[model samples]
Target: MILALDVHYKDDGSAKSVGVLFNLKDSQPKEILVAYLEETDEYIPGEFYKRELLCLLKIVEKVSMHDLEAIVIDGYVYIDNEKRFGLGGYLWQTLNEQIPIIGVAKNFYHGNNETVKQIYRGKSKKPLYISSVGLELDTASDFITQMPGEFRIPHLLKQLDTITKEK
Candidate 1:
């Protein structure tokens, strides 16, 4: 199964809300799981993973890893071309690098390495940034490009963002 994950933070940044959507390959999501967590760490510059990782790990603990084929996150996998680990990369390492992690970002990150792929979807002139660990870059890009939706963002990913914010 494939899972898409996203986190929404309270306005004051005191709490984090997380959403996880599960889907089979090439299919719409079959389930969505949400979690709320108290923020323990401050959001430090260049250290976003610290805050978001806690929220993600909490939600992930509720699911069986054996059923997880890949995890799609709403960020980058690398901070720069130098291969620095981003939130997604940290998650992959924390999980022992067993499950593949794909990072899809709506805005272009200036710090992103050259390895990140730019993909345009629907009729939007803007492109989504795609990065990955445990899978080839092109393959990961293709997966997101084919995700269920005609607009720029995939339906399931947009759903994740909506559900996360609703919490």
Candidate 2:
């Protein structure tokens, strides 16, 4: 199964994470899992993984690692051409690199053009910045490109964002 994850933070310092499990070709999620935290790390610029990684880890524990083909995160695997670790990268490492991770970022990270592929979807002129670990860059980009959607974000990913933000 492929899992897509997203996290939303509340003003009270609490957080909710949502995961959508599905096959690559599926247009809909097979299972939707959620995890919540009473308090979370404060967002620190240039160290975003610190704030969000725990939220992802909490949701990830709800599923079996052996069954996971890859995990998609709403961020970057590598933040720069030098291959710095991002939220997805930290998750990949925390899993001991057993499962692949694909990072789909709506905004480009400067100096990441060499490592990330810019993929355009639907009628959106802007591209989705794609990065990965434990899989070839092109292969990761292709997977995101093939995800079902009529807009820039894939259906399941967009669904996860909505689910995570629910009160």
Candidate 3:
């Protein structure tokens, strides 16, 4: 199964992390997991993983590691050309580098070229930035480009975002 994850922060110092499991061939999620974190690490500039990684870990506990083909996060895996560990990278390490983690971001990270791939979907000229660990950059980009969607963001991914934001 391929899992996509996203986190929504609330003003009360809480957060909701949502995970959607789907096959590459499917357009819909097979299972959706939601984790409510009563308190999360305060966001630290240049160290975003500290605030969101725990939320992701909470949702990850709902699934078996062996069954995951890859995990998609809503941020970058590598932060720059030198390949610093981002949220997805930290998650990969926490999992002992066993499962692949794909970081899909809506915006470009400046000075990042060696590890980032820009993919445009549908008729949208805007591209989605893609990065990863445990998988070739080209392979990871192909997965995102070919995912079942007619728009810039995959249908299942947008659904996952909505799930995280819903009250």
Candidate 4:
């Protein structure tokens, strides 16, 4: 099973809504889990994982860890060319590096290196930025490229964002 995770923050930044979509292979999600969490830390400029990681972890705990083949996060796995950990990286480490993590970002992270793969979907000239931990970059990119979607973002990922924004 593959888990796609995303979080939506409240306007006041006091709380957040998190969504986890579970799917088998390149299909639609078979299950969707949502969770609400009070923000414990302020969003620091470069350290976004500190604020969002807790919310993701909360939602992850609801699912079976043994069944998870990989986790897809809406950000980078590495913060820079030096391979510094990002939000997805933190999650990977928290899971003891057992499950592979694929980070899919809409925009290019200024700090990422050549390890990041860019994939174009549909007719969009822009590409999605992808990075991974525990899986080869090419393999991760191929998976994302083949995900069930005709637009810029995968359908399940779009659904995850929508569910996260729900009240």
**Any runs in candidate 4 off by more than 4 Å, and if so which?**
24-27
How do all models score by TM-score?
0.93, 0.98, 0.98, 0.93
Model 1 Cα lDDT, one tens digit per residue, 22-132: 564444567777777655578899899998898888778878899988999999999898999999999999999999999998888886758699999999999999999
List of clashing residue pairs for candidate 1: 80-113, 81-113
Clashes of 3: 0
Per-residue lDDT of 4-123 in model 3, one digit per residue for the tens?
A: 999999999999999999999788899999889898889899988989989999989899999999999999999989989999999999999999999999998888878899999999
Query: What are the per-model C-alpha RMSD values against the true structure?
Result: 1.6, 0.8, 0.7, 1.5
Residues 75-165, model 4: lDDT tens digits: 9999888999999899999999999999999988786767699999988899999999999999999999888888989888888888887
- The 10-residue segment of model 1 with minimum total lDDT is 19-28
Report the candidate with higher TM-score, 1 versus 4: 4
Query: Rank order by TM-score, top first?
Result: 3, 2, 4, 1
- Best TM-score goes to which candidate? 3
Instruction: Give Cα distance to truth, residue 54, candidate 1, Å.
Output: 0.5
